[model samples]
Target chain A: MLKKETYINGFSSINPIKDSGNEEDVFRCVEPDYKTYIDTIAVRRLGKIQRMALVGAKMCLENAGVNLPDAIITGTGLGCLSDTEKFLGNMLDDESGLHSPTSFIQSTHNTISGQIAIMLKCYGYNNTYSHRGLSFERALEDASLLLLENTENVMIGAVDEIPDSTLKITQKVKTFYSKSHRNEPVAGEGVHYFLLSNAKQPNSILLKEFSSIEGKVSYEEILLECKRILLSAGIETREVDALILGTNPNIDELHYQQLQNELFLNSNVLQFKNLTGESFTASGFGVVLACKFLLGQTLDERMYLKKKHSKAQTVLIYNQFKGISHSFFLLQNV
Target chain B: MPSKVYVTGLGIISAMGVGVSETLRSFSTEKTFVRHPEILKTLLKEQYPLGEVRFSNEELKSLLKINSKQSFSRTSLLALIAAKEALFSSRQKESPLGIGVISGTSVGGMDKGEYLYDGYIRKNGKFNLHDAFVHDCGDSTNKIVSYLGTQAYSTTISTACSSAANAIMLGARLIKAGKLQRVIAGGTDALTRFTLSGFRSLMILSDEYCKPFDQNRKGLNLGEGAGYIVLESEEILNKENRKPICELTGYANTCDAFHQTASSPDGNGAWLAISQALALAGLNAEEISYVNTHGTATPNNDLSESMAMKRVFGEKMPPFSSTKSFTGHTLGAAGGIEAVFSALSIRDKIIFPNLHFQDKMEETGIQPTTDFKKEVEIKHVLSNSFGFGGNNSSLVFSAC
Candidate 1:
């Protein structure tokens, strides 16, 4: 029910998959050379977490052809986990009151976005969303509101770091899978950023609609919300060229698959968790993939379960985790 | 057409007390709860004083009837306590038009996360993933969802101290934009050694009672608690014949873009935010009856905020005071708690005193309410909440 149309100008995704040097069946990001993007001063002051955030944000700005953004918004579940772990380890080891300010400064969830703004000298509006799965979507929603308010350009970044200690604790419960032990969903980390505007461009993808629902939602309710998003976009269910589901790949959880079959039965369905791995803000990578497919107008069969559609005019991203926060996004080629 | 947003209900739990009546009762008297914390499990207990909430985790769980064994963070516990009070007091727990939640938190469940970190360092073979789940910023929000029943939207904001103010702004925007008819917007934060040590590393923790807007102000004392406000559209208010606590007329957020930790000396961001907030409310500098300042007593903040107030109000500055003198700086929850206090001022027609203010700073001519006193005919109250990363926000509440 928005009166404005948000455009996806430029974006960058730095995860295990992209950072992966070779094409392995497993997912991981082969990181870009940080030495090239960041200067020596920042390199010495920042940690790995801040380095990735800076690189990812700079890539998007360069691609978008903008120097200073009007606003900077970010979404992260556990921000700068490695630095946080370092700080906490000192406290537990009885070595208190002895440490550098770098770890402590970067440990905050807002550090990613704040640091980015500081680097760019952007005095504009800045915010960060720290919700679990809904973090990225919330940031996007805030951007949409800004666009509606006539703010020209906004930058949204979704970044979360996974530390070894965190992985050890969660994997003990079998919540996350390992690369060698491939049956379960593995934990992932990435710095995904986007530059957006209200006006349409030649290569812009129309962010037609984005919606999220939470609390006491039933499977039927999720299906209904999906239908509402498509309906609001003036697109028929059968007309959707591809269905990109953000699933955790749990074979027991047939709810998403069953709902997809009943709704968009003929559309080619695909999943992204295999390539992007799993993080709280993985939806950023998902939406970026959808936009890339819409812009490229082609798909690589390896990333898809059903390879019926070769060209995607419109792509729908359906994502939910543990049946908690469910979100639907509709993207179309402009 | 967009409808006006109203504050139908408010719930707050701080070091002062629980529930609105208790907080108001404590506020009415000459009692302010600033002391060495008896509750927070910090190793620096002998070093820094705080305004920590008194209830234990078990006591809070019993009050809500939630099982003690459940993986509930202390942050979530405080949030649930305050949120439940707002819901029941607003009588909108079962709003048919759907309710959204926009809660703010800086560290989420870091208090619990710190213990898990201890396990990781000590090489403790036993590890519980439940603690990992509780550490997420959204975990407390999801818990509230299960307790609050059906909701249309849910999200968490983490912009340090300005978080709750931003949450309240978003809730009002949603209602005005007709995206959501009702919302529970505010923030909650719990104290932890991780945060306390971080502040200590930054050397911003004061050893004595925090003095706001005073000449001899040293630094800030970190506190913990949760505060929330129930926002409803005019249609819902009319449908239920509910009286509003105050009209949330204007709100704005602007960043200093200066430093990560220190505020700019010119107070440019703070002035922009306060001016923009006034513009949104369609009020002038002279109409503001009271100003609840974001005075953390830290030298940098008090000076910058004073300059910003001068820039906006010129020579006719309204009587302003920092309630933080009563409640130690609550970080992300400061905005929410201060907004509640601002509403209370409008509802009670009184301006609460700023405690421990002996001398005013030499910068220009600004003085806090030197004594605990009450005032009449207060129409509108402006509250300021500034945070690190230059994330500053201001809110205006007016009587209906």
Candidate 2:
């Protein structure tokens, strides 16, 4: 069977920072016009995750010039946190009486994916992956598989929301650091979306290959596997110009440092967790940052973990959620 | 050119039985698993019927020999049981040959969460935070992967009822694309109060046995179960010199985008998914020997699925039935269970009956096969699973 090539045609994202409008305006962090896309009625009903996802999805579709996608796939770690927290809190506060069903319904992990399908009127494949940090990467893998099978247009994304209860839980669990260390710590809400296609466009980036690694595999073994994959793709180690790392100042710095000191010692390393915070699906944001870097776009200095390298050809995005699920994607500028 | 994906082994655990043989026997005997809930200790047990598996959480944990001390949710236990059976049935001695496990789950650890919610809030619960770890839908898949002791390419798919079918689809894609040699694909979801009450709130849980495609169908009876299949690339199967039970001929997933919780009146997503699956299989609708309809016995589902069946199969639809009557609506696990059942049907050359059906649906002239059938030359089987948010999926199985 002949393999079909897949490419990332367009991408869009919405974060706490003002990043959705022009490519140059991503550095600006200002309040968005949430009322413009969402009305008071809908806003009151939606959880933070849903609202961010809807806006990000809309931006992605509009940017991709795709009116209706053939499939909608989403990934999140803790889905609809606001709703889940609300429902759980109500159960705790009011002893479960007088509890509305709306929060419970929205709390299901697949609600966002279902909502996207409903919003797009797209009667195609819809799925959501919620495997901690690798959630979005898994969704991307699914989209790539569909595109490889000749499915034309796919809308894929990852979204996470910062709910007060969840934030408290994270703090309790030590998943988040103090707010004073905001420069290097804590998780925040954001959504990143991509329109994928098999046919390459002038402005598109080619997805060369992707793989998910699990369990206690040695870093050397992972590097060897990555080397084999790159070799199969007819590329060499030194040919790779940049590596995008999903690093968090508080939690992931040790692992990022190990990666930097070990396998990526020779390559130009860049990190993005500072800009997007440490959400479970923030790796998807890392993918967006890699694409922006490959496109010769500048990012906010706050997100930079290492010096910027000029003229990167091949970029590798490596992300893992809490050291459980690891994913690596090799991307190249077209 | 399209790649061929083969189904090598199947494992299932439902109210009917623990393995494929028991499930098949129950199906042949026209035995229905629907009864008054005994396993789920809920106040509504007396008022509603459920498809509960007769196993305690401790018994399940002991059966699977998980010693994490952290309480395993019913969903994780069921998934581990089914996944272990799948790997064992595959007869593979290798630790990991680039094998992956993709399981679908809707309510991950809600069972445990609901049980310990108050205690955790009060800070006096015996619940380990790690016990609450499984609450995320994906954690169930992670637990399954850990239980199997194999880590290659594993992930979880959550599309509600269509989840396992999507898992199967992804597994097949990975093999066809030469990404992985083998994958354990399926779904597991245990019934929980969260889900039961959610369904009750929606008024979709029937108080009696479900009647799919029946004119008087009220709603579906919820059940809990897990099913998984071992899928391998042709190259791997050929190298191993193994006989495949069935070939995964085609699969497709489509979203209705019609409603958040209801299928479209026209079954647009169902129609597209079925049509796409058949087209990928390179077979006409008439070639389908049987269809495991996603007939949850819900009024909306039966009507919408019937319309979609008519649109796809036209006037000459094949023998179709909803096994949900036997296993109840397992939500994310339904697709996996039905996929295993479809493979069994092809292997045994038998058609399982739709347990509770009295009359034909008025919206469509579709009547499911109500009697057990045997010794038929089954060639192709199609299965449909649609879920909340209009997510729809269809899979085709053929004799190898």
Error of 2 at A270 (Å): 3.4
Over the stretch B1-400, how does candidate 2's per-residue lDDT look in tens digits?
A: 5457899888899988788878877776687887888888776778778888888888888888776677578998999888888888888757754579888888777787765555555555454566556677877887787777776788888877888998999898888788888999999999887777777767787888899999999999999999999998888778889888999989888788887778889889899999999998999989999999999999999999999999988899899999999989999999999999999899989898988788887779788898989998999999998988677889999997
Candidate 1 chain B: worst-modelled 10 consecutive residues by lDDT: B120-129
Candidate 2 docking: what grade? acceptable
Instruction: Please identify model 2 stretches exceeding 4 Å from their true place.
Output: A1-5, A18-31, A35-44, A87-101, A178-185, A222-242, A261-269, A308-314, B1-3, B93-97, B122-126
Docking class of 1: medium
List all candidate RMSDs to the true structure.
2.5, 3.9
List, residue by residue over A1-334, the lDDT tens digit for candidate 2. Answer: 1246777888887766544432321122233466766553744676666766777777787877778888788988877767766676655564424456787778777889888776666766788987776788788878877776668998898788766555644554556655543333556677889999987788788888777766556667666766766777788766777778876655644555666666665677777765566677877777788788788887776665666457677888777665655677788988
Model 2's alpha-carbon lDDT is 0.79
Q: TM-score for each prediction? A: 0.94, 0.91
lDDT of 1 by residue, B30-92 (tens): 556878877777667888888888888888888889975668998999899888888788876
Writing each residue's lDDT as its tens digit, candidate 1 over A57-92 gives 999999888898899999887777888888888766
The number of the candidate with the highest DockQ is: 1
Cα RMSD (Å) between model 1 and the true structure? 2.5
